[model samples]
Every structure is written in structure tokens, then in C-alpha cells.
Target: MTLLAGRRVLLVEDESLVAMLAEDMLLDLGCEVVVAMRLDKALAQARTGSFDLAVLDVNLGDTRSYPVADLLFERGTPFLFATGYGRQGLEEAYKAVPVLQKPYQAAPLKHLLTRLLMGEPPTREGTGGGPMPCGCHISREQQPFQVDHCS
Candidate 1:
């Protein structure tokens, strides 16, 4: 019923709980999700699987997910980075790739996914088309469920 219905999405996140939550969101959006909790597994999936889009965590424990991003780039796959660090977290080469600032919200996630599916090139501008500094900003209580701007 949504633009993402029946779409295949590769979700790469190091944290288990975050990954689970994001998987749930994707499932709710009617997407077939493949999750990679480590850089190696993510790289393998990027090499072998076909995906409509991918959401990659910038930090994967001891490593960064840029290699996976590179592979996806080579494949011409449309993917976005999910990080608390906004566009500043991305390397200079990948600044233009869309970013889903953590913690992920269903609405923004849905919006970005729809944009990618529609073949829209994500700009370096903030998720809402406004500029923001860092992407991560939880409430004073530090609730992990809080949704930050996805730039």
C-alpha cells in the first residue's frame, strides 16, 4: 500500500536493539529486510544480494561501514546512512548520500525510502531541506526512542 511495499532493503547496524527496531519499521512498511550487524556480513550482502535500497549505520563497532557503502556505490544502489552524526559523519566523498539521523522514526524512514524508490537524488541539505549541525539529539532523559532529524 506504500511505495516501499515489497521492496528489498539492506539494513546495516551494529547495535542489536537498534537493528531490531529498524527492522520492525521496515517490516511495517512492507519491505523485505536483510540486516547485517557486522561490517563483513554487510559487505557480503552488498556483494551478493539485490536490493532496492539500503540503510547503513556509520559506525559498526570497531569499524566504519564505508566499504559497504563503496560496494553499494559501485553497484549503483540507492542507499542512506543511519547515524547519530548527521552529514558531518560521512566522508567527503559520500556527503551527498542521504542520511537517516538516529534514532530512526517511521515517518522519515518512510519518506527517505520513498524518495529513493522514486529515483530522487538525495542532497546534502538536511532531511527537512534545512541545515542542521549534528544529527543526534535525544531528549534530556536520553530515551533511545526519540527521533532526531534525518539529514
Candidate 2:
């Protein structure tokens, strides 16, 4: 439906190439994306953009993305993170948000984001919760969902 087709999003990443690919994938998923390559920029956009969701990198160029996450949380915006170092390496506070490991394709990203955006709780893969294939980026350090796609 067109309602899902034009969902607005805010994307935060420091890498230019990754930013471009992720923007494309979000567009394919029907999101009109706004990008911020730094934490400040992302926070600015997160505060100002007409965003329905966010796809944020866990670490920005020089700062952790927790502040940005806090802003998104305040607005009740759902998000999926794109992390290169995997959930195993993050602080306890950040383990709850869904993650798309680096080198992911579009399909899984869509599945995860859709579930979160639709107000579906992301139960950690082992708790017999939301979606099946057990990609647990929720409530704990997930085992890292890897799809092996370059983009």
C-alpha cells in the first residue's frame, strides 16, 4: 500500500558509501530517507525531520549514537541499527534495538524494520517472541544476524 510506500526515515552513518547503499535500501522499502553522517547532524535531523523511523549506525564518526537514540526514543520513533562491530561489543543500554549487521541485504532489513515500525515487539530470538529465524538484537547482545551481502 502507498501508506507504507512513503514512510519517512532518518539515517545516521559516518561512512559515505554505506550511507548511500543504506539510503537506497530504505527507499526500496518505501522510506523517504534523510541522512546524517555525524552524531550532531543525525540528532539535528532526528529532531527536525518528518521521520517515521530511523536506521542509525551504532557509532558515528567520533561518538556513540546513544544520544541520537535517546532523541528518537523521545519522539517514539522506531529504528534498526546498522553496526559493523556487532551487538556483542556494545554497552548494555544499547542492546535492545534491532540490528542489521554490516554486509546485510535489503530483505532482512525490511523485515526487521517493518516489525519494529508496526509496533511489534522484537523479542530476542530465543525467547519465542516475534519473528522466527532467531536474530536476537533485542534486550541482549545478539548473536549477530549476518546476511553476507556487500551492500
Candidate 3:
């Protein structure tokens, strides 16, 4: 059974190729994905879009997506940050949020999403920690998924 079946996901990414790949992965997980390439569009959708969860790129071009994140936070939405800089890239206020390093694999992404959506603690194999804030920050960067743009 797919973990995210019937779940709607808002994917905020600036790079088209990365978005395409992530969308494919999300579809494979049985998730309905809404792609937003720019921060403004993502913000609009974040405020009004009906989605179960969101995956936001930390940086979008010259601007950051913190505003969108703030809106999502206000709405009590669950989200994960996809960034090339890992947890270090995020500001102190956002350190506790789940982070997925760039170039991620399908399996880890799936595991993380499952945990996030199911409200479970992130416990994968040897990794040990108390329940993560929402998701775990996996640092390894995969080769195929590179961050071309911030948003």
C-alpha cells in the first residue's frame, strides 16, 4: 500500500527538472502533487490550496520562501524543506523543521514522507533520536537530483 495515497501535496520548487523528478516520485507514492515554480504562486496556493502536506525549497531564486513557510505554519500545515545546504541552510527559527537534502532517493523520501504524514517519529535503521519535530534531516545528496535554482 502507498503511504500517501489520495493525499494532496504542494510542491514548491523553482527548477523545472527537479520539480518533474520530485513530482514523478510523489506520484509513484500515490500522492497528488501541485507544482509551484515561483514563490508568489506558491504563497497564493499555500494560503488557499487544499493540501495535506507541502515540500518547499528553502531558496527560490533571489528571494527566500520563508513567507510561504510562515503562511503554512499559520495554517497548521505540515511541510518539509528541500535544500542543498541541509539543516545549516535553515534559519535558527526553522531548525526544528524536517529537511530533505538535495538529490534525495525515492526510498528515503518515501520513509520521511510516511513519517511526516503519519505523525510518526523518524527512526530509520541505525539513526536514533527522540521524535523529530516533524521530519528528519538527511544530509547525503544524491547525484541525479541537483538544486539548480533556489525556489
Candidate 4:
């Protein structure tokens, strides 16, 4: 069985290509994906959306997505930060949250999501003695409307 089966995920990313890649990966993992490409839309969804977990981009254009993160935290929802600048890009308040650096591959992404949503540790073999990489940060692309889907 897939690791993330039946889990719902809220993916907040400003970059279109990155969002699409994430969506595809999440689908492959058997999780439902809800996408928001801007801070306002993401915040609205964060306030009202039902999700098992969230993947938050540290920055949404010129604005930070911390408000959304705060909302998710208040809702008791688990989340992680996706940043191009790595953990250094996050504010001190969120330092303990997991961070997925840019240019990551599928294995680490799946591993992290599985760990977060399922409370399972990533396999130790070949994990490089640290947090696994997950495809998060990528170059920007044209904006797309919000979407929610599962495979």
C-alpha cells in the first residue's frame, strides 16, 4: 500500500512548476492534494480547509506565509516549510519545523511526507545522516488557479 493513502494535503506554493511537481508526487504517494499559489488564497484555505497536513512555502512572492502557518498551527494541523534558502530562510519561531530544501528528489519528499503524516521515521539507509530532501523550491512559472485532486 502507498504510504500516504487517504491523507489530504494542503500545498501552498507560489511557484507554478514547483506546485505541479509536488502535486504529481503527492498523487503518486496516494494523498489528496489541494493547491494555493498566493498568500491570500492560501490563508483563506488555511482558515477553512480540512487537511491532514500542509506544505508551506516560506515566501509567497514578496509576502511571507507565516500567517497561514500560524493558522495551521492553531488548527492542530501538521506542516513543513519548503524554502530555497534552506532552514536559514525560516523565522526563529519556526526553526524546529522540518524544512525541504530546493532541487530535491522524489524519495526524500515522499520520505518526509510519510514521516510527517504517518509518524514514521524515514529509512536510515542511504539517508545521508540528516533530513531527507524533498522537491520543494523551484523556478517560478505563470500562476494557475487553485486545484484539489486525488488519484
Q: What are the clash counts of all predictions, listed in order?
A: 1, 0, 4, 0
Candidate 2 Cα deviation (angstroms), residue 150: 22
Better of 3 and 4 by TM-score: 3
TM accuracy, model 3 = 0.79
Clashing pairs in 4: none
Error of model 1, residue 123, in angstroms: 9.8
Each candidate structure's TM-score, on Cα atoms with residue i matched to residue i, is: 0.80, 0.76, 0.79, 0.76
lDDT scores in order: 0.80, 0.70, 0.75, 0.71
Per-residue lDDT, model 2, residue 140, is 28
lDDT tens digits by residue: candidate 1, 13-103: 9999999999999999999999999999999999999998999999998899999988987787888889998877877767767778898
How would you encode candidate 2's per-residue C-alpha lDDT over 65-139 as one tens digit per residue?
Answer: 888887876677877778877777566665666777876567667766766655644333334443323333443
Clashes in candidate 1: how many?
A: 1
**lDDT winner between candidates 3 and 4:** 3
Model 3 over residues 1-151: C-alpha lDDT tens digits? 7768989999999999999999999999999999999998999999889988888899999988888888876776777788889878977667656778887568756766776776632232233443354233434353344322112
The true-versus-predicted C-alpha distance at residue 74 of model 1, in Å, is 1.0
- Candidate with best lDDT: 1
Q: Tell me the RMSD of model 3 versus the true structure.
A: 7.2
* Candidate 4 lDDT over residue span 1-151, tens digit each: 8757888999999999989998888788888999999999999999888988888888899999999888876787877778778777777666656777765456656656665665422222243223433333322332121111100
What's the lDDT for residue 109 in model 4? 67
- Model 1 per-residue lDDT at 141: 63
Pairwise TM-score winner, candidates 1 and 2: 1
